[model samples]
Target: MKKLLAMLLVICSTASAEIQPEPIGRIQTLPDPYPPHWIVAVDVAFFHMNDGKLIVLDADSDDPAGRFKGMMNGTFIPVMYMAETRPEIYVLESFRARGHRGERTDVMTIYDKTTLAPIDEVVIPAKRVSAMPTEYYLQLVDDEKLALIYNFTPATTVSVVDLEKREFLGEVPIPGCSLIYPLAGRAFASLCGDGKLLTIQLDRNGKLVSSERTEAFFDADNDPLMEKPAIIDGIAYFPTFLGNVFPVDLSGSAPVIGESWSLVEGVEGGWRPGGIVLAQGDASGRLYVLMHPDGHDGTHKDPGSEVWVFDPQTKQRVDRIELALPAITMGLTNDDDPLLVTTNINLEVDVYNANSGEHLRTIGNFGQETVFLFHSDR
Candidate 1:
């Protein structure tokens, strides 16, 4: 097996331009005949202007090229959708919209990754997707199940599908604002959005095991202003734009909010939290949080990109690194060492040292793709 060595150090700079691509690690490049030890391959969703497609690239080497590529040329994909499966890409399109034949439709397409072939398609009920957002809305409960979050219709249900068999598992009614996430040994579905936070637990057998609700709303107190909670080791850490980190431990008899700490001191304007990445770093069983860009200006601009590292145990911010561009979807190598991979809005994919925010190498160009999304290294 070939190995890559990349060292990352906490580089503090007054400006974000100091970081550049430099060789610090070795990436094993695999050819047409994939080697067993190739380890991980990266997938990038390319939305080229009106034409959208998915591109799968191998990150084993600097010049390692894309293994699979497909195009949706004239096809229309919904906005604000997340693809959450492996070897397959799911795209939810518009409702009552004309397809190639001008037929009324609301459809989600599942494409095979290896062959770039259409495996199956799911048609959503017309009324369910007519809500305010008007986007093909859904969330992945896991690799298999998907919680369909639609609008207006109370009869709307979570459409669960068996990814392996490529069939519908079942549908369950989960009304209100709910965010579905894969956690621990099951799926964590939190119905929040409409003031109250109602959490439901789903077992591996596709059954509802238990349900709970928070008696209040997320406000200035208790660091309730965070976007969402990310769970690590059965513990959910909530980070807010107000610069507070709320740690909630759910491993006990009753879930309780454990510790709260201020991450950024007097953060001007507010701190907009981005993606949260957690991995076991040392022998002490400690986990770190990867925070995205934050600035004094109250803007959700694309260029506001920064990576902040924090000790989840202490709930304190330890290191901060600024990036050239902001990140959308990110992943980490599944090994003892840490290698951070991120796809940015600038249509570029970068490999960085997870511990020390150092840019090692970059792949691809962004001007070709209007939008870009990514999945974990598989």
Candidate 2:
């Protein structure tokens, strides 16, 4: 009996051995890529819309002072929308101003990064309904091909384009969904005028093999902040306007929504949750959920918001950072960098230490005003 117990103990110990997955490195370049030393990409508000330009700011020059000074004054963009290689930037333009009267045509300009000059300009096709400014999110799946999501209703379609030849490979119809976010060889999209999330998969022949509804919303007509699903560690994090966060597991035979997280912890619960960013360091641990207190009136106007950070591992609310100004959008600087909140107040981006809610740096209207990307030089 004693000898049998010893063998069982040994078997249990071996079963407990943990197999760790590789950490995803800081996203440096896209599939086929080239990037400058500093300033990965800046999303700026151009032509009155969120259409921003990507400017390269490198101070490691013969004349550091001169190079630094030159950055303050925007440089001519080689690419409009920052992509993988030859095309570093793709700027989707909108001619008409919001609430402005009448129809208008627009052009999307592509630029090269090294030279900061225009490479190609294509006219964005008009939509049947009232048009709004949207980005043509492009992903270079491989060396020769790219997955492109053209933004515009009626004209909205996901297609594969030949990078070398700029040839239209083919377009796949995404009914009910208007926005397509391409990541990890699959596209996660949300139905237009609805909060339902859908998953689209493409086979080797570039044909969209299966399209399935991943998650349905609480309300059919409710606009759920309309943001891209954060895909991290093979798990897609979906934070809804209703203060719910879904961590979907993709490792299984079929992807399943593992856990539902509530950002604001209270008897009544949180609402209008936006800007959900994943925590760094300990893998499969914490996730930061930014909540906007726009009490269910359905109008998205909120005065001053608070970010409630939660630890998924512990399944608890970690901390809260009250923003003096109302946050328009939020992002991260480093893997461990604090939450970078962008406010419409001063159009400034403030960085807070993720854990302690300490203000690190307010990268004020230093570069771009809108949704900005913070990359670590470390």
Estimate the TM-score of every prediction: 0.62, 0.63
What's the residue-level lDDT of 339 in candidate 1? 60
What's the lDDT for candidate 1?
0.48
Cα lDDT tens digits, model 2, 1-378, are 999999999998888885767788733322223222233334445443333544333322334333222121122111123454444454444455443445655444555544445566554443312232223243444432554545446655665554455444566777776654444554444354454556666665567777777556435455353344454565656666566666666443345656566655573543566431222221334555456654575533343366666666566776677766656555443334234434434665555555677665454434554433322221
Each model's lDDT: 0.48, 0.48
Model 1: residues with Cα > 4 Å off, grouped in runs: 1-50, 64-97, 100-113, 124-157, 169-171, 183-187, 201-211, 220-224, 248-257, 266-297, 300-302, 326-330, 343-345, 366-368
Clash totals for all candidate models: 4, 17
lDDT of 2: 0.48
**Residue 256 displacement (Å), model 1:** 5.2
Q: Where is model 2 more than 4 Å wrong at Cα?
A: 1-52, 55-110, 113-115, 119-145, 154-156, 186-197, 203-205, 214-226, 250-255, 267-271, 275-285, 299-304, 337-341, 365-378
